[model samples]
Target: MIKFAFLIALVAVAVPSPAAAQGASGFSVVNQTGLNMTNLTIRRFGTQGWKALGNAPSPGGRGSVQFSDPDCAFDIQATLEGVGTVVWNGVNLCEVKTVILNRNASGAIWVDYE
Candidate 1:
């Protein structure tokens, strides 16, 4: 019986669990230039307005900005970082800008765009 229990435990440990859903959505921005940016702001869907993510004084700096909701999803309007704001949905909790994720959503989390 003890051996069987041990075997079951081993099997459970070996199996991988499903990925956790985003608790709070956000973006991580890295300054990759020689100039400093001011009044950096980030906004998500269902929010009143843009929330200040962070500010960088110089290039090669990194910052993180979080959304109000863990499950909150948003459409990026006027990103101002890239060429233009692109529509995105189903962002995850605590996810930041540096990491690119698929906006298309399914059940609880956003999946990678195909």
Candidate 2:
């Protein structure tokens, strides 16, 4: 009986907590647009409030956001230097590790999920 109890305790110690099992809960943004990015923010999908992600990457650079919430779906918004603000809606961070921001020949902003 003592051996069984000891084995159970060892297993419990080896098992990771719920938060640790979840791993990292955020994605990195790759700035491919020629313009600098600023005022980056993220929020849960269908939510009204936005949480600032801070320190957006410059053109041809990358930035990462680490969120505490366990939700996998989120909306991202950023303002491009000398350009208007842009938003990428309903992005699933769980599936997408990298998001690339780009601009078309017509100067319209777009996003690519990777």
Candidate 3:
């Protein structure tokens, strides 16, 4: 009985969950700026409404957002505390695993994808 139970547990651990199988459709965000990201939203390119991804990954933290659209292009919006709102247009989530928020030397916000 003990060996049977251990086999079942090992099998369960080896099998991927549904969400993990679908991870190709989703992406992660890495916040590298000094300010806290208060709000994060995403929308399909050329769409009118924004879908909230989630709340603050405080400075230097990271978060993940799952999207359901079959389209690969999207626009991302972020609200940084004390810094107002910033948007990155026409990002291809299908090609990237992580979107990194960064600040340039000129004090402008920029993005990097990995």
Candidate 4:
């Protein structure tokens, strides 16, 4: 009985806490496009009213921004200055720790996950 109790105690000690068990709840956006990005906003999956990046109207090339997303899932939308917009639907932010916005071979906006 004592051996069993000791084994249970060891197992309990090995268990991870809630905070430690939590996955990635934040993300960073990397602007690889040569032009600035406008109206960069992100919202919880299926939720309304996208939250803007900041006061800036547009972000320049190679610029990056980080934001908190406790829910770990989101829908991102942004526009390229003087160009069309780029939208990422149903993104799992936890699985994608970083998002890189660039241009594809066809000259269209491409979204990459890192």
Candidate 5:
């Protein structure tokens, strides 16, 4: 019985959970750039028009935007109120659960991965 229990525990440890195995639902848009995002849009890479997400900063100054994405892959376009447009192309929504929006050292808007 002890050996069986040990085997079960080992199997459980070896297997990844549903959430871990599959992709997470609705990837999060993390804002670390300290700028309020006035607009957010997403669509397939290489597409023309974009679908608007909304006009709201993450939550706090350093919070993130959590939105639903059904596809495993997608793209993002974020517009800062006073800043310029920052675009990320061909983002794998499933694999990359969160897309970080921040400014680079040169003071230009850039995208970061986790």
Candidate 6:
């Protein structure tokens, strides 16, 4: 009967907690600029702190980054060579706007804040 008890304990411990069931969200970015760009960096702002989710060279000329936070409360920052943009998920920000890209060129980055 000891083996049966041990199996029951193991199964209980193996279950995932509610808090640990969080997942990442996927987002996309499009470069509307006629010129091709490179060196794309993505950032996610959280209660803990801001962190870089991922970075890659824009193969599509346009850049795309996914936010990997299930409970995302993040802004996005995209940097290409010497230009960058900061985006939030809201209409009204303290000083920064959500859809504003620092670069004068044309391009759009899509973000899904879960």
TM-score of each: 0.38, 0.69, 0.70, 0.59, 0.57, 0.35
Best candidate, TM-score: 3
5 or 6, greater by TM-score: 5
Per-residue lDDT, model 3, residue 96, is 73
CA-lDDT, candidates in order:
0.46, 0.79, 0.78, 0.68, 0.66, 0.43
The candidate scoring highest on lDDT is 2
Candidate 4 C-alpha lDDT tens digits along 1-112: 9999999999999997676555446556777677666788877888897888653233433434556545666777878767767777776666566777666546666677
Q: Which tens-of-lDDT digit does each residue in 31-77 have in candidate 2?
A: 88788788989888899899898799998999886766667667788
Could you tell me how far off, in angstroms, the CA of residue 30 lies in candidate 3 after the best superposition? 0.4
Q: Cα lDDT for residue 82, model 4?
A: 70
Pairs in clash, predicted candidate 4: none
lDDT of 3 by residue, 18-102 (tens): 6555423667888888877877888888998998988757888988776666666788888877778888788777657888888
Question: What's each prediction's clash count?
Answer: 12, 0, 0, 0, 0, 3
Off by over 4 Å in 6: 1-24, 33-48, 57-67, 84-114
Q: Which has the better lDDT: candidate 3, or candidate 4?
A: 3
Off by over 4 Å in 3: 1-24
Clash pairs for candidate 2:
none
Candidate 5 structure quality by residue, lDDT tens digits, 23-97: 435555677667667667877667787888655455334334466544555677877656678776777767665
Error of 4 at 29 (Å): 1.6
Better of 4 and 5 by TM-score: 4
The list of candidate 4 runs beyond 4 A from truth reads: 1-26, 55-60, 64-66, 95-97, 105-109
